[model samples]
Target chain A: MREPTVRTQKIKKDTTRTRLIFFGILALILIICSVFCEYLTPYDPYLQDLKNAKAPPSLSHLFGTDRYGRDMLSRVIVGSKASIFSTLLLVGLVTVLGTMAGVFGGWHGKRIDTVLMRISDMFLAFPGLVFAMAVAGVLGGGLQNAIIALMAISWPKYARIARSETLVQKEAPYLKAARLSGSGTLKIVFKHILPNIIGPILVTSMLDIGTMMMELAGLSFLGLGAKPPTAEWGSRMSDARSLLSSAPWVTLSPGVAIFISVMIFNLLGDTIRDYADPKSRGR
Target chain B: MDQPALKVSHLTKVFTRKGQPDFTAVDHVSFSIQAGECAGLIGESGSGKTTVVNMITRLLDPTGGSIVLNGEDITRMRGKELRKVYARMQMVFQTPAESFDPRCTLGDGIGESLRNNGRSRRETRDEVARLMEVCGLSADFASRYPHQVSGGECQRAAIARALAIKPRLLICDEATSSLDVTIQKEIIALLNKLRREKDSDLSILFICHDIALVQQFCNRVLVLYKGKIVEQGEVDAVIRNPQDPYTRRLIDSIL
Candidate 1:
């Protein structure tokens, strides 16, 4: 019985490893395609051909043409750059800024903690997309402003996670031992505290990727992000929304692209979360 | 003849909470440990034994009074100066596994102080190996995480980490309390061997509630009750002739 259980456990471990690698590679491929999307496109995503307008999926135009006769497949391929990279940049920005604020607040933890945490609470109190829309409306329509708007609301979540994690880690006996061993405040925070607290923070960030992507796309769909002719996934979907019944391929092309990318990223995040937590590794 | 390794005079800690009365944890507690001495602070739970230890180790700020280590008044020390004082004094906590950073290997934990003090990676590695061996842990155990090792092994690793800097005063705050009897004895023996090897250069403040264990290991013992040092003397003398009523009750309970 024990031998069979051990064998089954090994199999489970192998399955998790496979899922991790598979999703990891898929995510990498998406990133690489985005980076070199120009070369990968079969036709100019921006070039207009009124004669081939609203042409359905065919040998020449694989995902059909939009009302402007721009190749939908090429447009979706190019849109990956704006869609994926912006989400990544947003997640990176929030994680660093929030983690720093949180670590500082937790470590110092007096008037500073109260002030910073209250500010974070204020941010958390706002409905995320509505607040982002308001900020985007003020900042004016563009991908950067939309990102900046979303960033304003998203950072507080990371800050809260980092703060709570840091608070728990700050009182850990190992930290006390480190302090007693003559490690300075900076060394203790960077070397000991940060490393220990990072696991949860990383998992949180990984899980946020899909959400940020959707939010960014939602902003673009709402005309608050990636203005006309930029070939962003959300904007492409927005541009083809009118043709939904007649030439559904135009809208579905970018929608499908968004779906696949989001699924890959979300699955990757799930796999990473499972792998990072030791308790979940066996099962 | 020389200065005592650690000295505490009128050390006090009062926990102040908003809308609540200030509670005195350690009140006017005073004690000193001479060089090469193993001084035990014995008290029941809630007697402020750990509170006194915390104040001395600088883990908690003293509400009043002073702590002198190796004749230097460190009561007001902070930042660089406080860190400098940390080199001379170190603490081994109650739970050995919890006292080690789970993310770090045993070697890194043991070598942290040495690395902080400007020892190169190679030197720290060599020193960590030697310290682990001295603490009766094999060199291979250095690669293991805190959870990977048994409680006794982790305790040994904790001891090695404490001794890495060759601190003049080592504070063991119930260091062996979590271990089984046999393992506890082994740890005590290991500490004894280390003290013998370090000779008069080392001083130990062994905090424990087990009076029998304290009597066997410590040279001098301070009995604490309600944050006050109720009785104190050479271990043998105090055991034979109980002084304070609290001390008498403590002895009677054990006898």
Candidate 2:
């Protein structure tokens, strides 16, 4: 076996305290941004001031004003709520549906596995964005519809990963021992296989959160997500496109918000992935 | 005098990997154990020793065979019937670390077998403690998870879990191979103690690669080579006066 590296030691120490603090702070910020959206914004994001349009950054409006004189800071904060909420909802739906489908497909192999995997392959064949767009087009544009569209395209990834994990877990000696101990199918699947594979599932779900957020933003940018005045990052970017050359702050603020949010989620996901791995834990 | 503890006749297992030709893992293997007798299945890896044990425990359905345990034909059993058969037979797997749910503590893992067999939590807690003591583990260790304990302790916990339901047939599939030699001796001693104390026709199928270990523990020994039984007889007779070339080779390797 390879000796533990300094990097591994740092990760172990990092996981003990800093990781939890990071998540706590991120969650707290997002919650406060969501719950106090109105209070956090100095001006109504939709209210336009033609005279104040394209104003440079100042103490009154820290991020300055957009082409429509909408406060960039206000729009960014309010927009985060829509993106965060929709992504969280999409992830929740996918986790539940994907895990169930995976457990079933993995536990009952042969026909069930074959059919479920075929369906997953079909979904995988379509480019995720194209698939989401098609679904959104069919369902029509709205926050809820975009979430539903994202879920339809995203669940297959979880299903495939979950099924593979479950299949491997099912063959493990402990699972076989559980079966020989007279554990029923339900008990074996839920108690033995599910618990064993949960580490991977959790890590994947965390990573998927970032992907789902980006997808939601993309849909919003394409006008297939939340409608105007909804204060979503994608829609804000869409609204500011015409003023890209003039009032760049409108696009810059929400664009920066999207980037930071996605980066934070990705970082958190990577941390979780590293922590959940047994090899990494040993270090 | 009661029905033989286990009757395995013509047990054969074939594995046909995808895109590969069919191959026999256990070829027409047959054996019978009297009540309370310890039978050792000795073989090298890929010799199908574990497969036979798996088949007997109903973990793997045999391609061709009949396993009659306590006069019940478990070979044809399915679902509920198989589960009922399982209640009477338990297995201690190799790699005790992998034998447990890492998320659960040792007590939980042991208690799980009892729970599966319909033992209540209140009833099982005391029994679990008692079983842990019988397996030479302290009751306090029950609170620790598998990872928190040594490999030997984990194996003991596994043995205790196997014995939880008071199984008629206990299959140890290289159960002690992953442990140190001293720990292996201790585990072997524990098995012998449990066998004598239970005195309830508790048959054991001790599977391992070490012929010497089996000779010390089991009454009867079956030597397997390449999925076929090359030699088998009373432990002393086979160990002292070998029969097949393969058996002699194995003995030579061990000595």
Clash-forming residue pairs, model 2: A79-A231
Q: Which segments of model 2 are wrong by more than 4 Å?
A: A1-16, A36-75, A277-282, B230-232, B239-245, B248-255
Instruction: Name the 10 consecutive residues with the lowest summed lDDT in model 2 chain B.
Output: B78-87
Calculate model 1's interface RMSD in Å.
Answer: 0.8
lDDT of 2 by residue, B1-255 (tens): 767999988899999899999999999988888889999999889899888888887778889989999898878778887887777888899999888877778898888878877888898899999999999999998899877999999999999999888898899999989999999989999998998897857999889998889988999999888888888899999988998998888888868
Instruction: Name the regions of candidate 1 deviating beyond 4 angstroms.
Output: A1-14
lDDT tens digits, residue span B1-255, model 1: 588888899999999999999999888988889999999999999999888888888888899999999889999888888888888898899999999998899999999999989999999999999999899888999899998999999999999999999899999999999999999999999999999999888899999999999999999999999989989999999999998998889889988
Error of 1 at B238 (Å): 0.8
Model 2, global lDDT: 0.86
Position B191, candidate 1: lDDT: 94
